[model samples]
Target: MTTLPTSTQKKLGLVIDLDTCVGCHACVVSCKGWNTENYGAPLSDQDPYGAAPSGTFLNRVHSYEVQPDHGQAALVHFPKSCLHCEDAPCVTVCPTGASYKRVEDGIVLVNESDCIGCGLCAWACPYGAREMDAEEKVMKKCTLCVDRIYNENLPEVDRVPACVRTCPAGARHFGDFADPDSNVSVLTAERGGIELMPEQGTKPVNRYLPPRARDRTEDVDILAPFLDPIAAEPQGFMGWLDKALTAMPGGR
Candidate 1:
């Protein structure tokens, strides 16, 4: 079994804001695009043109409808990837020395060259972080864009993971969680960020920001606050359009 370092130099990972995420899947698309071409292993597609298309993607998003204790039912957009746990089960379960955790940056990575594609690592991961690439005959996962983050050829600002870089709603932040002053750590403290499944004892580095409270007292009309056909005009096209819209269900 692989043993983790007693203390890592830095816990570098992502902090995602569930409240700000719009379920747009921009992070998903961007992650697939960049990582499929440039990272450790090319995320392969198996029978892409077939009726059932499946590919090796590092990031995924799932939407869920949930009713919080005090708030109305809301659809939550959840983005999932490798959390890179301190005591990663995938690393300990690897028969080959392919899976390992870096003591310097605290990033868990799989060496494709050493992987045998036995599927033990994937089965060990409770978070569903590992995926086997049939084409490469190896397991692949999110490496935090390790190549890009440390590449001196790229600009300083362009070093973040593809998912963090392309999020339109500013929902994703990347930084060192070990540093209390880092943006990720500050955001985690301020937003009450939570680990996904603490009972598993993985000690995942990535954290998720819970949904912010919604104002139930503030009554917000869905579609009627701006309709005023009578005040605009009786004969104009604007008046006619407004009247037509107001007649629809919940429009007024």
Candidate 2:
């Protein structure tokens, strides 16, 4: 079994905003595209065009309908991936030492060459973040786009996880948690970000900003002003018309 470092030089992770995410799946598509093309093995799809399509993906978004205490029900989009926990169970469970975390940036990764297609890591991950690539017969998980983040050849602005760059709603943020003044740190502090399953003691570096309470509409009449009569009584030409109509035998 592998052992984790006592401390990482930098705690690099993501901060996902549940309120801003629209469940567009753009981050999902971008993660699949970048990892398959640039990372280790290509993520394969089984019977992609057929009925039961299954594939390996590092990132996924789940939506839930939740009723807040102060507002009506709301739909929250939650994006999940490897949290790169400080005490990652997946790393400790790997018998071959294939799964490990980087001391430099705290990014957990699998050495595909050493991987024996064992499902131990998947079972150990409580968040269900790891997946077995059917075609490659190897375990796959999020690397935080290591190749992209540290590549000096790329533009400075593009040196982040593909999911963050491609997120249309700007719900994903990547930064160093070790730096108190970092963007992710400040955002997490301001938004009151919470860790996923903190009781598990994984000490996940990633944080999630909860969705804000929405306004209640059950008691509000949006059209009340427009629906009100312009005048209590008819005036101008309409008054004469009303008098003329009242004079008719059938008029009310």
Per-model RMSD to reference: 7.8, 4.2
Would you estimate the TM-scores of all the predictions? 0.85, 0.87
* lDDT, each prediction: 0.90, 0.94
Instruction: List runs of model 1 lying over 4 Å from the truth.
Output: 69-71, 218-252
Error of 2 at 175 (Å): 0.5
The clash count of every prediction, one per candidate, is 0, 0
lDDT of 1 at 58: 83
Q: Please, what are the lDDT tens digits per residue for candidate 2 over residues 102-197?
A: 999999999999999889999989999999999999999999999999999999999999999999899999999999999999999999999999
Whole-model lDDT, candidate 1?
A: 0.90
lDDT of 1 at 148: 79
Pairs of colliding residues, candidate 2:
none
Give the per-residue lDDT of model 1 (tens digit) for 13-129. 999999999999998898889888886778889899999999988889999999877657999999999998988889988888889999999999988888889999899999999
What overall lDDT, based on C-alpha atoms, would model 2 receive against the true structure?
0.94
lDDT of 2 at 164: 99
Worst 10 residues of 1 by lDDT: 225-234
